[model samples]
Target: MTQSMFRRHFRTPGTESSSAVRPLRASAAAGPATETIASYLNKRLAEIGVRYVMAIPGDYISDWVETLDDPEVNAGLVRVHPNNEMCATYAADGFGRAGGGKTVGCVSTTYGVGALNAVQAVAGAYVEHVPLVLVNGSPSVAQFNSQRDQGVLWHHMFDGSLTDLRIYEQITRMAIRIDNPALAPDLIDAALTACITDSRPVYIEIANTLEGYAVAPVSGRAKLKKSPIPQNTLSLDEAMSMVLPILVDSKRLVVLGGVEVARFGIQDRFRQMLKVLKAPFLSSLLGKSILSEYDTPYFSGTYNGRNSQQNVQDLVNAADVILSLGVQETDFNFSGVASADFNPLQPPGLPLQGSIEVRMGAARINAGLTLQDQGELYWGDIQLEAFVGLLQEVVCEPSGPAMQSLVSQFPALAPVQAALQAANGQLPNAPFPGLSGDIWSIPKLTPEQYRDQITWDSFKSLLHHNYLTSFGNDENQDAPVLLADTGLTFYNLNNVKVPQNGFIAQLAWGAIGYSPAASYGVKLAQMALGSRRRVISVSGDGAFSQSSNAIGTIAALGLDNVVFVMANGVFAIEQFLINAQAFNPQSKTAFAPFTRVPETSLWQWVKLAEGFGGVGYEVTTNAELADVLEKIKAGPPQPAQPNGPCSGSPAPGCCTFAPDATPDVRPSTFTLVAVRNVCNDLPSNTRWKLG
Candidate 1:
């Protein structure tokens, strides 16, 4: 059969298409004999556009796994087995984030140990506001009843108490346990609804005995519709009444976009607001790529308090009024390590006094006006879409001549306009000097120097060069890039322009080793959705070593992804912080010894990649780096053929004991590029002192 025909044959009955799956409402007329709870759960997952479930198998979940494994009952949801529960959960988080917060990523783990292992990953997802459904298999009803009623013990039980659900409550938006099979459908719907509405991880514990139990057919009212966001016209009017004047009267108006802009899927609306105001905007560190730097004319630079570019700082600091949309003023988002002395109640340098801050579902305005009382206008549960839509409607537009006059009034507008023009002409051959901004000050180095010396500046320049020259402005063709948990990588790579919603970073939670593990899930989602974008995972040596085992899973699945390891022999960010803080070298504090990460001679990443059945390259210079990037941009690598079906043995081209015998027709290859760099070399312009 043709690929299209094969897909159609396996498509679920109620889903519109594989790419846009919508859940089907339960039919009360269809009796309990229609389908088992396991099948119902799988179908629900398919309805939510979950193309894959990243999971690790355990005895408790074996029955559910059997249902997932069965082609007839599994629908189109593919089950991916990762090396560990942590990797599985991280991959799910990546998948959800890459879907622009609409797609709900699913993961299944066995109870107790499995669920506990995934808590850290789920916590990261919670803080980052990525929606995920964690399906955990619990003890059977009989086993649980015996434990509770007869004081019997079971394997994986924690001190004779089912405390797993309690543990998850702290990290997830909802922790639901399906004790009665008849209420399974309602409970499942509640959990899924909470996951979608809140855009955070939710936990659902399915008793092993309930898998085959007959549940009441879902009511027709269960169809998944867009969850309603409570709106108040009076509050919206109050917000506009208070902030609109300040926005119009201010000489220099600036917009600071944050991660919620992307999480709420309002990039276009936010950009429209900028166009209406005709003002410059800067993205918060976590909100990088909320708007495409290349496509948006007014995008200045990323703002992170003291660590921001001097021009960006000057513009924002000097602004008459600032409008911060969906911004969460976290320590890292504002001042990074310098937040030690930074006050959260007030903005740095009292910017909040003149700022209109819109977050969650409320707008707070502080115009610094003498007679007005600064207060918050609550919009109930109104989402960013509705809020931005209101702004677009109410915002007054200027005539062509008036806009021109307004543009000419601000002295800072010239640099922003110049930067936009320069960015437009920044082709591969464009002179580095022509790029006129503090952010564009890339180090000029010859090819020989690029190859001979791998300094921090040179590495960043090469990355920016490759990204700008190769990727261009075509977001359609570009894949999402995942940045590991390290300040060095994030600060340096901030200059590289990404399309809106094309960058993923664990900024708020800052979990190390997330990039490599999460890249697998991101790539899997992209492939399932029929996107051709390549997955790029960038990690520091310290971060890479923590999740190096993920390379095996990447190779095993034959995923076409690239892992770039910045092999800077130490935890450079920590060292930089220690030095900047003037921590005593002889002191017995944890920071003293922790700064020096022990070097390992045996930990050759390239060799480890080869052992995991992937091609590895050690890039010492720009020349070698360019070659590897060229190959990646060209296409995915050919699939390695397995020696035999389900054989747990190593083969030249195939993954051992691979679950899917049918190789991805598209070329699938993995590459680990180890870029050697100086141990203590920090990104230029890094500010480590507390504000």
Candidate 2:
């Protein structure tokens, strides 16, 4: 079943090359040109309602980019602050994640070199079912035949660079080379249509020189509006018959969710389903904190720094039935199994008993409980919401006592409490001379210590719960606070329960640097909605470095929030590579480029904050963290944060700020101008010292 899904829908570049194509764009059949190619492109882009173009142009794209810069074009460009093709592609991928299925553009110079550099990111988008419009500039169409002069000897150019015939076909829905300037507009439209309609990346290559070349007649085309996502309807009788019995008979039932839950906008429906059944639920990193992140009885905590996979499996194996909503059998999820019962862990000779019911989209399976409802096939964006409604209509109480009773046997485990108590009930003093420890840093204390900290009031203390605790404040926030990027965090999180205003995460495409970019968008969304909720981005320092420039954006916006950076130098997930090669005991697993940034210079981070007109502080222990947060909450907001172009400028849209000022060494060398207030915007007269 999985192979069929991967094969039929996954179009390779070879197939596209062999298939004949027709143009759907406007170009003068045989007449004088009127509009510049750049003008025509801008007009077409505007026609498609695309205003944002993200890129770092090479010489090939300089003309088109410069054309776009003209006031006449008015197209917005997000000059991604990344050093290489990989990160650039990541920013574009992040842009798509936040853009909500709209075409978030990725532009690069022609030749297979640049395109090849971004192949991994493009592959991620394709495999994860994310839509990305990739525009690559190539050498001029006229140069395709001549093998002597320029392109023949060009440094980055390859013999068949214009048509990266070998690779593009493997990862994209369609890869087309626009050789005829006249046909480019139509080709562009077709490629874009393919991208949006198929919800995957499409490659449209334009000769570096042909980009925005004169087009006698510009094609009048509408940007392709994705068809309303088709919804897979289920037979009420069959669905209820299958699901109801599990609800009425199972004593230890659980629900699992993933990205599709959010993609389909069914978080609320998921919440309703969980509530009606009172089943303990768990979320994958892809589905982390969808509803909430604090503590909740239903949160199984199967994902995260601690491997709760066994705990999750225990519940699934023990239950008479397991219901999965929008769960994909991706390797990172479900350990590549359609059902946990079928997983390798059961005694080799032993027979498994329970069933796992999956209610999801088009992919098929021969699992214990399979809902082949075509509604799942419907690719409409609203399916999540629709699924929610369907789930609500069919409900049942727990088979017997609520599953909470089963969990009660474990009692409230307290790692932090025991740690504190054992340490004579005294917390370590602040690491720095003038701050307190951060209580939030204690994610792995002894079990007894974890149990001691348990309390009832959700508002006052950390609940003896899991990721599901962040849900419901329907009136205020509609999301979760914790936003984890596609680093170690994405794989182990699930059952997100964010408040109405709480934002769980938007890294649907499994790309790194997503959280950093999303942080800005989420904060901006909150501000636009007039919500004052505190936003938090808990990311690996590795991911933070990917879009570290965003720190400038945050500071500039003066977003009232915090970024809890996990300092572990390793890419946590890489360790799990060993799992992929189960047969090889000595499989070397390590993150590439094992370079470590000195821990001593984090003050530069503070400088980054101050540079953008915000406050920055460093802490080493939990106690100091708690104290700073207290001070932050109590302190007044800073003076208006200085604005930069595209975001947080004092004026509507000023691009005045730079992540690194002139010398670009200020942060690494500068010290706090003054520590007057941890929350203060750098007042004009503030002074600082160097590290």
- Winner by lDDT: 1
What is the TM-score (0 to 1) of candidate 2?
Answer: 0.59
Instruction: Show the colliding residue pairs in model 1.
Output: 640-653
Per-model TM against the reference: 0.83, 0.59
Best model per TM-score: 1
lDDT at position 514, candidate 2: 58
lDDT of each residue in 1-691, candidate 1, tens digit only: 4665333322322333542433333332344455656777777777776778887887667666656666656766787878889888988998888766556788899888898999999999999888899998887666777788988666787854668899999999999988676788888888777787778899989876456556555434476544746676556644554454455456667778889887766777788777655667788888887877767857787887766666777777787677788887776666543354756675555376677778787776664631355343444444567667765554432223322343355443334334323434221111211112754556666757755647667776766666544666655657445554555676666656666666777877888789898888888777766676677888888788778788878887888788988886677666655565322234343445565445434467667767777778887767777677777667766665443343445557755534743233222279888887765455665643422
Clashes per prediction? Answer: 1, 89
Q: How many clashes show up in model 2?
A: 89
